[model samples]
Target: MSAELPQPSTTSLADRVKNILIQPKDEWGRIDAEPATVAGIYKSYVVPLAAIGPVAGLIGMTVFGVRVFGLSYRPSFGATLSTAVAGYIAALIGVYVLAMILNALAPNFGGQKSEVQAMKVAAYSCTASWVAGIFQLIPALAWLAILGLYSLYLLWLGAPRLMRVPQDKAATYTIVTIVAAIVLFFLVGLVASSVTSMFMPRMPLPGGTLSVG
Candidate 1:
């Protein structure tokens, strides 16, 4: 009898998924649209950062007051857990929405345009932020650096994929983006803090009163 014919081996679906997860970008199809992409990133960053900083600061201050001042607790365990979960969901949605809107806006300019793929990239980066937030208790300094690096990595990965500018343009845009974002945030923080404080109406009881907030 002739030797049995060899059977074709097939990769299972799980194996396919694993391969996809671990797959690297195709070097041959690489894009160099950094300028437009980086500009897109900055556009997304500026608005959301402007919006969220105050909310974050308020949350931080509220948590600290609760712990340090030992304010009377009204919320039940269920309520607290629900609020935390809700907050996480809200943040994720907010991040995604911010990316989508700005990406839609990126293509209007001559120097910059949006790549649809960037939406996925931005989502992934924000997802990383969500995951890393779980480790916020990690030694404060180290955690800060880790969060920052993760953010930049996501931005780099997601932004350029959707941008279609030349290498020099991309690099320049990226640099300007970082620098301008830092400066912009400083100004926003200064302005937001001042404006919010002045207009937000301070609660009178400096020492102790019912804030419920």
Candidate 2:
């Protein structure tokens, strides 16, 4: 058998988050050189961070409730909890799917594909968006999560280096990958919603049943 690859150093999660968000160019360089495994990345980074949005949104909706047309409506706890769990699972699957897309499309954009490298790009580039999930704590402020669009900028910078794409083609690569991700997540959302609805009980509201958006 071949020799084992060196394991990545134990970098604190907070430091990694700060570096990726504050100085992604430098962070990408480190990410490209480090040895990482799919399990390690998911356990150390993706699992925890990806939970932020779903968990926060769960608390926001169930605790504070949603107000529409000067009326307050709260979804049933079972529905809210189930939706949160489904969304969280979807996020975990989404990252892996995105990495696959990045690796598959790498050669088309003049980049050499490496699964680990694609994963690093996919996982780390999402730091901004995951961090921004804190906005979900207050439904009204959830719109501020738009700031997470910075992840697109991070993807633009990291893809060329990690995927070995030429700078000239990086923009196209990033855009295509993003479009693919949108479609993938959209489908995933539909499936999750459909499945959740099948098991979710109908909750009566003042005028209608509580809808989990």
The TM-score leader among the candidates is 2
Global lDDT of model 1: 0.39
Global local distance difference test of model 2: 0.84
Per-residue accuracy of model 2 over 1-213 as CA lDDT, tens digit each: 998975964779999999999988898998888899877898899999999998998899777777666655676777778788888898899889989999999999999988888989989988888899889899899999988889878888887799999988888988998888778867977977786665453445343244444
Tell me the TM-score of each prediction against the true structure: 0.42, 0.87
Shift in Å, residue 181, candidate 1: 7.9
What is the lDDT of every predicted structure here? 0.39, 0.84
TM-score for predicted model 2 compared with the true structure: 0.87
Looking at model 2, the pairs that clash are none
Worst 10 residues of 2 by lDDT: 204-213
Residue pairs in candidate 1 whose N, alpha carbon or C atoms collide under 3 angstroms: 33-165, 34-170, 35-170
